[model samples]
Target: MRLLAAVDLGEGLESVVESARFLQEGLSIPAELLHVVPTPYFEALGRRFPHLRPGLEEALSQVEKEVQKTLADTGLRARVLRGFPAQVVAGEALKSRLVLLGQRGTGTLEALARGGLARYLLHRGEVPVLLLPRALKAVRRIAVGLDDSPASLSAFRVAEAWGRALGAEVFGLHLVSGQGGCCFPTYLDPETLGLADVLARAKAHLESLLKATGVVEVSKGDEELDLLRLAKAREADLLVLGSKAKSTWRHRLGRMVEVLSSQSSMPLLVVPEATVW
Candidate 1:
C-alpha cells in the first residue's frame, strides 16, 4: 500500500509536502512524490513551431530539477513526468492506495475551467483521494459521513484506521431528512417524538455497521449543513465522505460530496465507490 503525493509549482507545495509527511507517518506507508509538467500547451506550440521544441525541453528539465531539489532530504521517493496533470495522476493512482493532493480552494467555475484535479479524481479515479488545504498542518480529529453503501462504509473504515494511527478522535455522522422537507427535527429536541425514534434507529444502524463504540452521532436537517455542523461541533480537522458511482457524470458525485468539496473548511478525504478495505 503506497501513497502518492502529487505536487505542483504552486504556493501550496510546502503544505502538500507536510500533509504527505503526516500521512506517511500515520498510515505507515511509503510515499512517492510526483510532479507532472503539463505538456498540452508545450506540445501544441512545439508542433506548430518546431524551433521551440528545444526550449520547451530545456524548460521542462529545469522544472524537474527544481522539483528534485524541493524534495531533497525529505525521505520521499521523487519522480517527475510530463503529461496532462490529471491523466498522469490518475494513471499513477491505479497502483497507489491513496493519492494526496493540495487544493487551491478555488470556486466552482474557476475549478471547472482549470480542470481541477480533486474534482476530476473524485468522479473518475480508482483510488481514494485526500485533499489538504494549504493551511492544514496535521490531523488531530476526523469526521466521517456514514451510510449503508459500500463507499460510505469504506469511508468510515478509513476514518477508523487513520484515527487509530494518528491517535485522533473519530466522529461518525449520519444525517436524516425531515418529514417532508430537506430539514429534520433536531435529534435532541424532546418535543419531537418522531426525532427520538429516528435517532434511535440511526444509532443502532451505525453501531452495527461500525462495530465501534461512542463514535457515532446522528443529525437531522440539511445533509450538507448538518454534516458540516457536526464536524465543526467535534472540532474536526479532516472531513471524510464517500462518492457513489453512476453511468452519468451528473449522478457520479452525490449532492453531499459536491457541497462539501467546495464548502469544507478543513481537509477532505473522499472515498470512491466500491472501494475495498
Candidate 2:
C-alpha cells in the first residue's frame, strides 16, 4: 500500500514529516513526499514582469532542493509538482491508501481560505486522510469513535490495525446521544433499556465488531464534544473517526467528521467508508 505525505514547507512541515517518519518506521511501509507549487500564480507574475522569469525559475529550483533535502534521510521519494494543491493531492490520493497532511494550509492566504485543502480532500478524495497539528510529535495512543453502525466499526478496525503495527494502545468511545440513550434502542426512548443495559450492549457490540479487546467507554453526551473530551482525557496521540462520502438519513458521520476536521487539536485519522484497510 502507498502512503502519501503532502507537505507545504510551512510551519506544519516538520509535524507532517514527523508523522510520516513515525508511520514509516512503525508500519514499515513505503512512503512518498509531495510538494505542490502554485505555479499559475507564479506564471501570472512572470507575465506581469517578464524580466523576473529567471528569478522564478531559481525559486522553483530552490524549492526542489529543499524538498529533496527534507526526504534525504527518511527513505521517502520526493516529488515537486505545479498545480492547485487540493486538486493535485486529491487526484494522486486515488492511487494511495492513505494521505497525510497538515490541518492548516501553508501561507496566510491559504490559511484564511477556511477549511480549504483538507476539507476538499475529506469530501472528494478517495483515500483516508490523516491530518496532523503542528504540535504533534508522535502517536502512542489512538482513540476511536465507536457506534453500532458499520461505519464506526470500520473506523475501529483501521485504528486497531494501526495500533497493533505501531505498538500503540487503542481505546473506543461510544457516545449515547440524547436522541437515544441505548445502543440497541428500538425507539427514541426505550423504556425497557436501562443505562447499565445500554452500556453493556454497546460494549458488547464494540467487542464483537472490533474482534479485539480494549477499553470501550459508553456514555450519554454530545458526540463531538464527548469524543474530543475522551481523546484529551486519555492523552491520545491520534483521534480516529469513520466518515461517509455522502450523507444518509440514518447516519451523519460526515457531520462529525467536518466539525473535527477543523477543530481537532491532535492528529486526526478519518477512514472513508470505501477504505478497505
Candidate 3:
C-alpha cells in the first residue's frame, strides 16, 4: 500500500521522520512526502513586502532538503506544494492507503497539525490516519480495543498483522458495562462475566475473538478511561481501534477513538473496516 506523509518541519519533524521509517520497514511500502507552503498567506504578504517570493521559495526548498536529508537513501519520494497545510494534505490523503503525521502537545497555533487537521481527518473515512507522538521509538506493544462487532473484528485483524510484522505483543481490550451504573469489575472470570445470557455471550465472544486474533493478553475495562489507563500502565507503544461502525448510535464509538487519539501521548492507529486493505 502507498503511504502519504506530510512533512511540516514543525515541532515533531524528527518523530515524523522516524515514523515514516518505521512504516517503510514494517509495511514494506513506498512513501511519498509532501511539504505544504502557506501560499495564500505568503501571497498576501508579498502584496505588501514586494520581496517575499525569494523567502517563500527558500522555505519550500529548505523543507525539501530536510525531508531528503532525514530520509537519506530510504527511497522516499517527496514533493513541495503551496496551500493551506490541512487542505493540501487531506486532498492528497484521499488517494493513499495511510497518512502519517506528528501530532504536537497542547499548544495554540502549534497544535494545528493535530488539533485542526487531525480532528478533520479523523472524521473522514477516506483512509486510515496514524498520529505519532512528539517523541517516538520502535513499536513493541500494541493495544487494540475490541467488541463483538465486525468493525472491531476487522481492526483486530489489522492490529494483529502489524503486531506480527513488528514482532510486537498484541493485547485485546474489552469494556463491559451493566445497569445500576455497573462497569468492569476489578477482578474478572467466568463468574465475573455474569450469569446473564447476554453477558455470557459477550464474555465468550471476547475470549474467542482474542484467541482467533492471536492477542497475547486480554483485559476488560469498565470504561474507555480505564482502557487508556491500562494502556499507559502496560507501556503500550501504540493503540488501534476501528474508525467507525454500522449503526448510527454505534458510530459514536469513533468519537471515542478521536478522543483517545487527542489525549493519549502514544500514537493512535484507527483501522477502517471499509478499507480495502
Candidate 4:
C-alpha cells in the first residue's frame, strides 16, 4: 500500500521522519515525504529572522532530501511536496492508501493542549490517518479499542486489515467503564444488566464481528487508565479509535477518540462513526 507521510515542518518533523522510516521498514509501504509551507504571517516571521529562517528551512529541506535518498538507497520510491500543510497533506492523502502524521510538538504541555497537526489530521482527514507519537519504538502488533458501536467496528476492520498486511498480531480490546463517577450516565450500570454480562456480551459481539478476519485476538478489559495505558502494556504499534460528532462541548472534549489521540504513545487510526462498510 502507498503510505503518505505528512511532514509538517513543525517541531514534530524529526519524529515524523522516524515514523515514516519505521513504517517503510516494518510494513514495506512506498512512502512519500510531504511538507507544507506556513501561511503569510509565519512567512513574514521567517523573513524577520533571516538566519534562523534559512537554517530552519535548510534543516527541513535536508529532511526531505534525506528521506528521498534513503528511499532511493533502499530501492523504494519517494516524493516531496511543498504548500499549505493541511491542504497539501489532504490532497496527497487522497492518493495514498493511508496517511501518517506525527503528534504536534516535542513539549509535554504542547502535546496536552489541542490544535496540533496530528490532532487536526485525526479529526479532519478523509482517509484513514495514523498519528505517530514521539516515542514509538517499533511496530510489532496493533491494538484496536472496540465498543458495540458501528464506528468501533469500522476501526476494528481497519486495524485488522493493517495487521494482516504487516503480518502483525491484532489485539481487540473492549473497555467497559463501570457506572458513574466521571463517565457518561448512559454508560453507567449497563441498564439493569450485570457488568459481567455486559462485558461478556460485548466480547461475544466482537467475536462474531471479527470471526471472518481470523487474524485478530479478542479480549475485554475495564476502562481505568484509558485505552492508551492498555495499548502501552501490550506494546501496541498502533491503536484504533472511533469518533462521532457531538453537540455538547464537554462530550466532544471527553470523547474517547480525542482522549486516546491526546494521550496515546502508539499511532492512532481513527474512523468516523458514520463511515459505511
Highest lDDT model number: 1
Rank by TM-score, descending? 1, 2, 3, 4
Better of 2 and 3 by lDDT: 2
Sort the predicted structures by lDDT, highest score first: 1, 2, 3, 4
Which 10-residue window in model 3 sums to the lowest lDDT? 179-188
Clashing pairs for predicted structure model 2, backbone only? none
Question: Which 10-residue window of candidate 4 scores lowest in summed lDDT?
Answer: 180-189
* Evaluation by TM-score, superior candidate among 1 and 3: 1
lDDT of 4: 0.63
CA shift of 165, model 3, Å? 2.0
Q: Tens digit of lDDT per residue, candidate 1, span 1-277?
A: 6899888767767777888887787789988899888889989999999999999989888978887887765677888888999899989998899988776656778556434787778878478888776645678888888766667787888778888888888878888776654434233344455776877777786778788778788777655767888887888898899878453376577777877777676788888777775
1 against 3, candidate with superior lDDT: 1
**Residue-level lDDT tens digits of model 4 in 55-118:** 6777767866765665445333456655566667776776776777777544668775534655
TM-score of 1: 0.87
Using all chains and alpha carbons, the TM-scores for the candidates as numbered come to 0.87, 0.82, 0.76, 0.71
Q: Point out where model 3 deviates above 4 Å.
A: 44-75, 107-113, 178-201, 209-220, 245-253
Which stretches in model 1 have alpha-carbon errors above 4 Å?
73-75, 106-110, 113-115, 181-193, 246-249
* Candidate that would win on TM-score: 1
